[model samples]
Target: MSKIMSAPTLHHFSSLFTLFIVLLHHSNADVGTASRYSPPYLPSGCYGTEATQFPSSNLFAAAGDGIWDNGAACGRQYLVRCISAEQPRTCIPDQSIQIKIVDYAATAVSPASAGGTTMVLSDKAFGTIANMSATLINIELQQV
Candidate 1:
């Protein structure tokens, strides 16, 4: 009996192990639907005209009822990844964006996506994880 694996066998085994790790890495998070909203993202329910409220990276989001926590959610940062969507291949591979919660989706002065979204990402934040054409995407949300 051979105790050592052949080169090809070892490569295959390593690939499988890597795949398992990638899958496991993304699984530890809350599953939710994320929609996008455009600019003029001011008069936020939390900040209310504070210039410093919005991040320069443009990665920011508004909390839906799921995480709103009655205004407690404000200013919380989250790591979000596009997991799935109505159309296939919408999620950008190996991509995730960190977003700060600047407002509440229901009460934001800016126009947001249709109701019932778990998070309303800013336009730039939404585009980072998924195609712009996708109006909404399934997201893996994790507070960091």
Candidate 2:
């Protein structure tokens, strides 16, 4: 009868929906775990250098300017030079923060003119500690 056939279809649809939900849940869990650990993509024995120059624009913004949306999470650990608007001419304070490298420029420009390497930070990381909008900071890679 039609009712009997409809019952089998309903059961099949429900089972598929359950499977989809399980897959979605599993994928989310995997992403959460992955964030806690550094990606394996960084090669062994690779180390970043300290920046002697600073760029003209906010380092964080410059770094993120041309990157994809995924760049929001791109920061890594960095040793940086921080300067306040009160003392713009000389950058005296030194700090360390984890920043994501968002842009790759063959030549350096703005905030501070780092030779060839540059990086950006998440809005939270940039704003909270470095004060990215008005403060200038120089970031260098930290050896792992």
Candidate 3:
């Protein structure tokens, strides 16, 4: 004789299966998607120069210990991409912005306060990649 599952039991199992499928899809998607790093910020002070002197259309980011490259990293460049963002907004997919390191941020002003973000973008830089007004956004950083 075969035993029949109760209605409630069947419903519960269905819900679990749906959840499993969703989780599996997300996990597989993650494999092809670039991971996003958090705690991004827009620095108040950068190189003590006028903003106009900097490349407005291009992207720019702040560095932490990496900036202490004995002035070597001062002019280094990188390719930045918005991978994810907090609620009310999401990263602009596959958008790559080239940026340069123009400033240095202390650990105090880095990740912890900025949500553990190692790179800080300038206002113009952030605006180009994000449509929101938030000061922080997740990004993919690559040295160039």
TM-score of candidate 2 to 2 decimals: 0.26
Number of the top candidate by lDDT? 1
- Candidate 1 wrong stretches, greater than 4 Å: 1-28
User: Candidate 3's residue-wise lDDT over 8-63, tens digit each?
Assistant: 99999999999999888732111011212233333323445445535656466565
Ranking by lDDT: 1, 3, 2
TM-score of each: 0.80, 0.26, 0.53
Lowest lDDT 10-residue stretch of candidate 2: 28-37
Identify the runs in model 3 with alpha carbons over 4 angstroms from their true place. Answer: 1-53, 56-58, 66-70, 107-116
Clashes (backbone N, CA, C under 3 Å), per candidate, total: 0, 12, 3
How many residue pairs in model 3 have overlapping backbones?
Answer: 3
Whole-model Cα lDDT of every candidate shown, in order? 0.92, 0.34, 0.56
Collision pairs in model 3:
39-114, 39-115, 111-116
Residues 1-144 of candidate 2 have per-residue lDDT tens digits of: 454548889999999999999888732110000001111212211122333222323333223223323444233333333333343533334644444343322212322222222333333444544444443344333412
**Ranked candidates, highest TM-score first:** 1, 3, 2
TM-score of 1: 0.80
How much does candidate 3 score in TM-score?
0.53
